[model samples]
Target: MTTTTPRLTGEYAIDPAHTRLGFVARHAMVTKVRGSFHEFEGTAHLDSEDPGNSRARVTIKAGSIDTGNQQRDQHLRTNDFLDVPNHPEITFESTRVRQVGTNEYHVTGDLTIKSTTRPVTIDFEYTGSAVDPYGNLRVGLEGSVAISRKDFGVNWNAALEGGGVLVSDRILLEFDISAIKQK
Candidate 1:
C-alpha cells in the first residue's frame, strides 16, 4: 500500500490498547495524583473537510478506575466520590466539533458522571496518523479538560492538617487516543 494523507472522513473506533482515559487532581493541597479508567469504549465520525460535521461519543465504566493504590481507588468508588454502585458509567456525547486551527479542535459536549450531566469543552490536537502493519489506518489525538468534581455530584473531601482539602476541587480529564478506521 502507498502512504498518503490519512482520510478523516470515515468512522473510527478507539483502540483501547493504544488509548488512555485518565485524570489528574491535587492531593492534600501539595502533590498531584494521577489515575486512569481501564475500561472504556468510544467511537467517532470524522469529517475533516467539514469539521463541524464531525462527532464523537464515549462510555467509561466507573468501577474500572485505577489509582495505583487499591485502597484509595476503592474509596473513590464509595458514595464520597464516584459512587460507582449508583452510577456504573460515565459518558460523553459531543454536541459540537470545530476545527480551531491546523490539527486543533474544540469539542464541546455533555459529560455525564454520577447521572449528572454538564457541558464541557475539551481541546484536542491531532497528533497524526499512520497505517499499521496489519493495514489498519489509525489516527492519534491528545486532549484534556478541567472540571469541578463538585459539579458532577462528587463532593467528597477532607480538610488537611494545615489548610486546604485532601483533594483539589478541580480535576483534569485527559485523553490519549489512537483510533482505527472502520471498514
Candidate 2:
C-alpha cells in the first residue's frame, strides 16, 4: 500500500496536465512574448534529505511550441528558430542539485537545443505537496533560467526600422512541475 503522506524521495514522473514548460523573451526590445511547449515529459529522483542525490531529466517536443499565434508558431519551427524538422526535441539533464535555502534548490544541468548544448543552473522552489483524490503523492516545484538564444544555435532576428532587433537575444525558460511519486 502506498502511503498518502510519503516523504519526498525516490523516482517520480512529472504530471503534464499540471506542469508548464514555457519561455519568455523580449519582443521589439520593448514588450515580452510568452510561449509554452504543449508536449513534454520529465522524471526526477528526489532526495530531499540529501539534495546532492537528486536529479531530473526532461524532453520537450520542439514542434509543440505555442504562443497562441498560428503563423508565428509555424515560423518558429523553421530553420531560423527551432528548426524542428532537424531537431525534434529539446532536452535537459541535471548534473547537480543543491539545497540553497528552506524549500529552495539550485539545479545545474546540461540543456540541449537545436543540437547545441550548454550548462545552465535554474533555481527551484518547493511550493508544497499533497495527496490527490487518486491517492497519488504529488509534489510541486517552480523554476526559471535565462539563456542566450544564440548560444543554442537559435540565432534568427529581424532588424527594426528604428533600432534594436525584433526578438531579444536572451530567452527565459520557465518550469512549473507537479510530479507524482512513483516509489
Residue 86 of model 1 has an lDDT of: 91
Q: State how far residue 171 of model 1 sits from its true place (Å).
A: 0.2
lDDT of 2 by residue, 56-82 (tens): 999999999999999999999999999
Model 2 alpha-carbon drift over 4 Å, by segment: 1-6
lDDT of each: 0.92, 0.92
Clashing pairs in 1: none
Q: Write the per-residue lDDT of candidate 1 for residues 1-183, one digit (tens) a residue.
A: 012242657899999999999999999988999999999999999876687888999999999999999999999999999999899999999999988878889999999999999999999998988889999989899999999999999998888889889999999999999999999
lDDT of 2 at 136: 95
Model 2 root mean square deviation, Cα atoms:
3.0
